[model samples]
Every structure is written in C-alpha cells, then in structure tokens.
Target: MPTPDTRRALFARGTWPEASRIAAVLRLETVGGALLLVATALALVWANLPGGTYEEVRELHLGPAALGLDLSLEHWAADGLLAIFFFIAGLELKREFVAGDLRDPRAAALPIAAAVGGMAVPALIYVAVVSASPSAPAGAATGWAIPTATDIAFALGVLAVVGSHLPSALRTFLLTLAVVDDLLAITVIAVFYTSDLAPVPLLLALVPLALFTLAVQRRVRTWWVLLPLALLTWGLVHASGIHATVAGVLLGLVVPVVRSQAAGGPDAGPGLAEHFEHRWRPLSAGFAVPVFALLSAGVVIGGAAGLADALSDPVALGVIAGLVVGKPVGILATTFVLAKLTRAELDPSLRWVDVAGVAVLAGMGFTVSLLIGSLAFGQGTPAAEHVTLGVLLGSTAAALLAGVLLLHRNKVYRAIEAEELVDEDEDGIPDVYQR
Candidate 1:
C-alpha cells in the first residue's frame, strides 16, 4: 500500500486545457441558468394569476395524430424539448469518459460512487418520509427518484456567481457528478417509470438509430441528413412507451468524440461531439430547456394557506427533505468513507466544508426533478402540483444556503490568492504559472 503522504488526493485540479474548456462552458451556462430562473419565475407568476389561462395554454394540443405525435404544449416541452437537454448531457458524458478527466477508472470511481449515494439516499428518504405519512396518497412512493438529479446549469451558475476564486477542482467535480447523476436519472426513468412497453416500435427505432450512427461515424455533418433520422428514432422511441429522451442519449453516444484516424488521429482537432455540442448547446440551453421550464414550473399556489397545505403533504415534505438534507449528507458521507478506505485525502486546497457546500449545491434539482415529478404523478394533478411546489422550495433553500456558504469560502480563497500573487511577485516568478 502507498504511504499516506504518497497516496494521491481526490479533487486535485485537472489538466489546464480541460479546465479552460470547462470554464468556457461554465460562462455560457451561467447565462442559461439565469434565463432558466427567469422563465421559472414567469411560470410561477402566470400560474398563480387569477385566471386559469396558464393551464389552458399548457394543455393546448398540436401535431399530427396519425403518427401518435399529437401532444399538449406541456407534453411537448417535457418529451420533445427536454430530449435536447438530455442530448447535450449525453454528449458531455461521452466526452468526459472518452477524452476528459474521467477516462481513468480510478478517477471515475469517486464521482460515480458519490452520484450513486447521492441518488440512493434521497430515494430512501422519500420512501421513508412518505411511508410514515398516513395521509400520503397511494402512489406517493413513486416519486422516490425525484430529488436524485442535480441541475448542471443551476449548480454551475451558482458556483460561477459565488465561487470566483474557488479551486477549479470543485467545479470539475460538480460537473462530473452531475453528468453521472444524469445517466443514473435516465436509467431510473427508463427502468422504473416506463410502463406498457411496446417491443415493436422499440425494435423499429434501431433502424434509424443505426443509420444515424453510421452517418455520424463517417463524418456526416449535414443537418438535413441527420435530422430526419434522429426525428424518426425519437418518434419510434416515444411510441415504444420509453421516454423519447432516451433517443437523444442514444444519438449523442454514437457521435465521435475524437477525429477519425483518417483525419490525422485524435490529437488533430476537436471531434464531432465537440462540434455538435457547440452547435446545439445554445439552442438546448437558451431555448429548449427554458421553454420547458416555463411550461412545467407553473403551479397554482392558492395563497399562503395553500402553500402551507402543499408543504404539509407528506410527499412534498419528503421531496424537500430529500433535496435539502439527504443530498449533502449522502454525498459527504460517501466521499468521506471513500477517502478513508482508499487512504486518500482531499486536495490540499479543499476542505470538508468545501465539499459540504458543494454537496448542498447539488441539491438544486430543478429540471430533471420536475420531469420526474410529472412522470411519477400524472402531470397537472394535485400531486404533481404539490411536487412542483416542493421542488421549488427545496431547490431555492439549497441554492440560498449554498450561496451563503460558498460566498464565504470564496472570500477565503480570494485572500489566499492575493497572498500567492504577492509571493509570486516578490519571488519574481512569472504569473503564467497561475494558469
């Protein structure tokens, strides 16, 4: 066994190029996160307005009925638009594992384990909380997975805002954690939530999926060539009673993460994955996700009393507890135990408190939580309404708490940074080393 001093620490900063790319992505997502909040706020305001217009608009239906494509505006937002979001997530996941920091199994293990613990504990909390409630509706336990997701945009946006001087490792860890969380969330939805599975459409979906895969592998970048194939796959998956978002992940996974050998090897340049991400991420973040939030977030809060009643419901309480309490506890405990067992330490610059704060930040499960809420309890039902309210409350509380903690941590890091700069200046070492 390696001595304690020799054992590598967890959360050490990754390579400079990777950090640079992550920073750029963070910058873009911060704006997307702001838009997400604005859209959600608008939804809440519109839903609570005196008239029932929000519901009517959300229920407005369009599309061809012949292909089973006719769906409500709300359904489109959930099933169609959110597929774009998942596609971006899938691309990120593939890049991370294939070419990013998580390529090494040892490096991947920590975040993967953390993600699992983070998910499992919240599910257990939800189950326990609802099980103990005599008044909990029959299917309340179905929402156990609701708090398991971490909204990458929201969490990263908060970090970018509050932790300007914090270490890059924390940001990297959170991003990786959320990626793994998304994969697990997708799994849970496909396995637990799917009902009335139709094998024929699912089998048929592979035809277009295979064609799309071959085209992308051969470096086909034509939107016209790929778009129809992708749409057909999505439609078939939807008809299979599997969430259409699964098709997005499938499509993203097949995209090349590095340039082909014929194109001068992996080091030649960015690959199709990066190319597609650059092209589609803005659309997914700026349009698809925000529009989905606008359509999904509206819930009628009758008044303070109404809000209180919703809070009092066991299911709502369970979600709040899972997000607010379970996330941090599960994450921190898992990380601590892993560090101990592996005889590893945190990176010199990181502290348990820093991990705690980030763990709390992970509790901001907005987008996927809402999606799962609709799936668990049929959309627009009273149960779903309470769930929306719960998710909002829990996420808001988590963001506020994490904000306060990280802001303080950022100040400390700032002071340390200043001291380092002063030392570097006195020593006459070039500032390029800071990069």
Candidate 2:
C-alpha cells in the first residue's frame, strides 16, 4: 500500500483538481451558462425592438480618450472584460499543461487531435462556402475562424440538461477537448487577428510581463504589487496593436503552478494557480462573460424577411455549415483515425455514438465565436450582423440535435446505472428478496 507521503506527492503533481473543486466550478459555470442565455435573449430582443436604445447603449463611448483607449461600450466588453475570461482560460491551460491530462501524451492524444481537426475543418468549410458564393462580401473570408471555438459553459450546460446519465469519461472527453479548443482559439486571436505591428509597445510589454512572472514565481501573493503590474502589462499589450486578452493568458501562464518551498511540502494545500482560479473563476463566469454576451450577442434580426436574408446570406450559411457540420465531422473523424492507427480502445462504457453526440455538442460555439465575428467584421456592420445570426442559428441547431441523440443515450446509461445501483446489501448483492 502507498504511504501518506506518496499520496501527498501524487496530489502535488496537480494533474487535476479535487473532485469537489471540479464540481464547484461546473456548478458555477452552469449558472453562468443560464445567465449567458438570458443575456443573449435580452440583447436580441432589445436590439430588434423599434427604439435604437440597444445600439446606443452598446456604442456609447466612455473610456478615457487621452490614452487612445476610448472604446465604445461594446468594445470595452469585448476587449476589456473578455480579458478576465481569457485570464481564467490561461490559468486552466497552464494547469493542464503542467499537471492535467495534456501532460500525459497517451491521455491527451485523442482530445488534442480532436481539437485540431475540429478547428481546421470548420475553418475550411467556412472558407469554402463563403469564397464560392458570389454574394459574399469582399472581406467575408476573414470570418472563417468564427465557428472554430466551442463554448465550454454553454456546451456543458446543455450536456447537464440532456445527458445527465452520460458516462463520466464522456464528460471528461468534452472538457478536455473544449479546453484545448480554447487554447487554439486564443492562438488564432493572437496570430491571425492581430493588426499593425507596433514594435515599441510590444517590446515594452515584456518588462511588466517579466516582472509579473518573477513575482509569481517567487510566491509573491500581494494583490497591490501584482494588480498594477498586470494592468500595465495589459495596457502595453493593447497599445502594441495586439489584442489585450493575450496579456491575460501570458500573465496566467507565468504564474507558477507548482507549490513553492515556502508553502510547505507538496501536500501543503493548493498551489497559487488553484487559489487564483478559485478566486477569479466566479468573477469571470458571472460578470465578464455574461456582460460580454449581452454586449455582443444583440443583433437586429431584421423581421421575417431580414431573418430569411441573413440565413440565406453566404457568410451566414458558411458559419452554419462550419459549426453544425464541420465540428462533429472533424472531431469524430480524427478520433476514429487516431484510435485505429494507435490501436487504442475507448472506455467500455462509451461507444463511438456517444463520442459523436459529444462532438455535435462541441459545435455550439457562442462566446468566443461572437467575439471573433466582431473582430472579423466590425460589430454593427451588415457582415457582422449576418455572422451573429449564423452563430445563433448554428449553435441552436447543434444543441437541439445533440439533445435528441444524447437523451436517447442517457436513457441507456440510466438503465445501466439502475442495474449497478441494485447492490444495496453490504455484501454487494441485490437485496431483492429476504433470502
């Protein structure tokens, strides 16, 4: 048997959170997901109403203009508040790379492949559909990346409702794939979406970033020291012509994931990353994301004719195809090919059909998709409006389809669960009779 020290060391590896922490985070995200839906609905309704109040609220400029940061309310939500969400994403990415499933090549291979394929196929499908359509705008091709993201909160919330009896491994698979998807989406934002190379601010950003890294590595826990430094880094990054959210990810990654010597041995409770995630996750999910959703998801769907025009638009069709069709095809194909080549078998409780359902669920790209749509085509533009409609329609279709398939799967799993729960006696036998 393993000793207590060994158990402590094992826990210290930080590959995953304690079950309770995961549960807490999931519950919080579920609530956030519901709020996200509410925000999106309100935005849609408010925007489509007769008055122009929604546009005024979204477009109102309020930030300090002197520093060249006077962005509109929507821009602030997209560029400013979204940074908090990215920061939490960065923390999760660091944890996964340092101690989670990604650290294990064997364990991470399938999901990593799935995430890549999922992203790639969607972009290709979008590009193909938009480029081939004569009605597509000149710059419509840039929005190919919009459907490449998978909204974790939204997808998981749907799963919780429709697949309550899904095998535990299926949920793990979805979570891992979504995490990797977020990482890829972040990379896309940094690389493909950046404009105008401002070398000075970009280079200057490193100073604060490096200092932030040093403080966190040395176990400096003071908020005053870190907060200003973080803000400075964000400002420099924003000024550098790079999206400000990249700074959040960089700052998160630099935070030391392992326990320091000052924090006792490996078993001396959670590390700084875990502590920070717990403290910030609620803020990110509850405030940053919902606010962003409210500000971004509101598109004036022009009545029945307008809705028809949007759905028929080449850009919208491309987004719909990319998300609803491409995401699942890419994920399922990649998983199947990799499993065949590697001779790896899935958990006995999971079938390829279950994976397929999860893949379909992954197509529900909401948060990051909307953000990318705004970036690809400036918000409130006709192209942007079409992209918004596509994301909403595509995600809804995927959710409804996945719900049907998963509900059927859930019934099967429930039957199995019932059988497994029959062992009521201490002897591990069904006490069906007094015999």
Candidate 3:
C-alpha cells in the first residue's frame, strides 16, 4: 500500500481510469469465491449429515419477537446478511446504468432483451409446471423465480480462471446479460418473496436511506458517517419483514457519482462510492459470497441417499429444466432469431457459435439463485433441497459444455472463420494446404 499522503494525493486527483482499476480490485471478489468453492462444497456436504448443517451455522441471539416483526438468527442471516449481497448487486446495477455496459442504447439492447426473455421463459415454464400440479408444494411454486437468476460473479470467476480462449465480445455480452438478469431476480424477490411488512419499522428503515440520498446530493465524502445509518436501516428492515437485502440495493442507488472528471487531477467525486467499494465490497464479495455458498450449496452425499425420491418431484424437475434447458435455449434462440431477422451481427471479431456456447455458461446461477431459493423456502423442505440439486447439476453441466466449446477452436465458430487468409476451393478447404 502507498503512504497516507501519497494515497491522499491519489484520492484527491481521481484521475484514475477507476472503472478498470476497480475491475481489477473487484476481481478478487470473484477469485476468492472460486478459491472458496471447494471449502464451501466440503461444508455443504458435511452439513447435510444428521448434525452437519447444524454444526456450520451459529445462531445470533436477536429478538425472538418485535412489535409486529419477529426474527430468529437464521432469519436474520438469510434476511440480513444477504441484504448486503443485494446492496452490492444494486451498486453493480447503478454502475452499469451510469457508465457501464448498459449505458449504450444500441449495444445494450440485445443483452437487456435477451436477459428479459431468458428470465420470462424460465418463469413461465415453471408456472405452467406448477399449474399442471397445483398441489406441488409450498416452496415449489415460489421456487419458479429462483431459476430465473444468473450469478455473474461466479460465472465470470470460472471464465477468468480459464483465460482467453473465449473472445472479448462474448465475455462482454455474457456480463451485460447477467447484470440485467440480476436486476430482474431482485425485483422478483422484493415483490413476490416478501410477506406482510410491519409498516412502522419499514418506514423507519427508509429514514436513513432518504437522508443518505440527501447527503450524497450534498457531496458528503466521508463513509464513516454512513455507518450508523447503515445499522439503523438494517435494523429497521429486519423489523420491517422485508428482506434486509433490499436495503443494500437502496444504499447502492444513493451512492455518490460525479458528473465529470477534474481537468487533469485524480481526485474527483467518486469519493464515498469508491472508498466503500474498495474496502467493504471486497470483504462482502470475497468473504461473504463464499460463506454463503458453504452454508447453502452443501449437498449431502450420503444424506441424499433417498434423493432420487426427491429428484422425481416436479419442482425439482422444473428447476433442472429451467436452468439446463430453458436458459440457453431462451438466450440463444432469441438472440439468434433477432440477429438474423434484423440482420444484426455482433462485432466481426465474435462468432455467433462462440456466443452460443457462452450463453450456456451464462446459465450457471450459483450464489444469487441460491439466495432467492433460501428466501422462497426459508424452512428446508424436500422440494427446496431438490431444487438446489437441480441448480447445481444444471449449472455444472451448462458451465462444462460452454467451457469445452470455448477452450478449443471449433469449425462451427462462424464469425472467427470470417477473418482468414485462406484461399479455399469450392469444398471449403485451403487448396494450397490441402495437397
């Protein structure tokens, strides 16, 4: 780390291409998560044993009852800890809207539309399944929304480890699409997953959020002042019965953003947002995500002895279908038909075939998807467990297929083939090299 004065100089300048810099910093969030996936796997497996799940989580002694709101420890974690995740998600959303990929109307349209289609189709399929069997289960019907999400950080983490076998265009496309998918997932959670709110605390929660917004408009740069507000908002929401994660999103939206850069200095107006992300974001994304994965993704190897019985359930089956079949088909089919109909092509450097393969990878929705599932099914049921299995299997299969396709050169990668120095005969083989 640089000296304080030096850092302050850098801070005051704000001349950094902060987006790229933050990208590098935020990369740790994903990489650490990837590193933690193994431990998470072990913990999950251990937890599924008779006493294993019980072993992993330590409950906090909070209110067993509020005036109108009551919460136990798990409720707090699921509702509270996860709110931080959503807050980060909101930050990602705001950044994308401000200067990120979604800033471009034309370039952004395809992914936005594709994400919408991807989310809608999966949800519809799930609803139809539920309608066909009205008595499916309590959590089962609610779980339709779970498969509609795409966890960008986890997916991109896998891609980063695999390196540049994939074209830049495909990566950008997948990232933009995943962000849109995340937004949709959040709305579904806030609207569909919540129960009757205790208005007193809910109103109280908004107080600091409103003040926080005002502070940003007033250009208050220090993040320390917001700590008390963060606590108050969190407590208010916890009592409010809305998923506390909504607070994260609200705070993210109010984060300070500058209109433009200083003439030639590095110090500019990203002060609070930049500082918060630098410290808190890495902790949340790096540590929090993995902890969540360990807590949620643990599959009981032996505990699942009767899993086949559970797997046969329609809720489970629909989740498998939605992420495995529905996501890719929805994403690729829409993109393909739209591009062909409109005669719209991707950047000449990208192959539609390659993009299709990445679309498969985009279906890997581990973290946020599980968060929604946890919210949808607060108490573990056979159906909830099975749905989790479907997400794992489906996401794994999709990621593997996409990775394999992207790892090596494929003749089907039409766009890549477009740029070549080959003199080919009618049979499409280079005449000079063929003989």
RMSD of each: 10.1, 7.5, 6.0
lDDT of 2 by residue, 283-346 (tens): 7877788889888998888789999989889999999999999999999999999999995656
Model 3 stretches astray by more than 4 angstroms: 1-26, 50-73, 130-135, 263-272, 299-304, 341-345, 409-435
- Which whole-number lDDT from 0 to 100 does residue 370 have in model 3? 75
Where does model 1 exceed 4 Å of error? 1-27, 260-268, 343-345, 421-435
- Sort by TM-score, top down from the best: 1, 2, 3
* Candidate structures ordered by lDDT, highest first: 1, 2, 3
lDDT winner, 2 or 3: 2
- In model 1, what lDDT does residue 323 have? 97
| Candidate 1: residue 220 Cα off by (Å) | 0.8
What's the lDDT of the predicted structure labeled candidate 3? 0.69
Model 1 worst lDDT window (10 residues): 6-15
Q: TM-score for all predictions?
A: 0.90, 0.89, 0.81
Local lDDT at 208 for model 1: 97
Write down the TM-score for model 3: 0.81
Candidate 1 pairs with clashing backbones: none
- Cα lDDT tens digits, model 1, 137-229, are 989999999988899989999998899999887887788889999999999999998999999999999999999999988888889999999
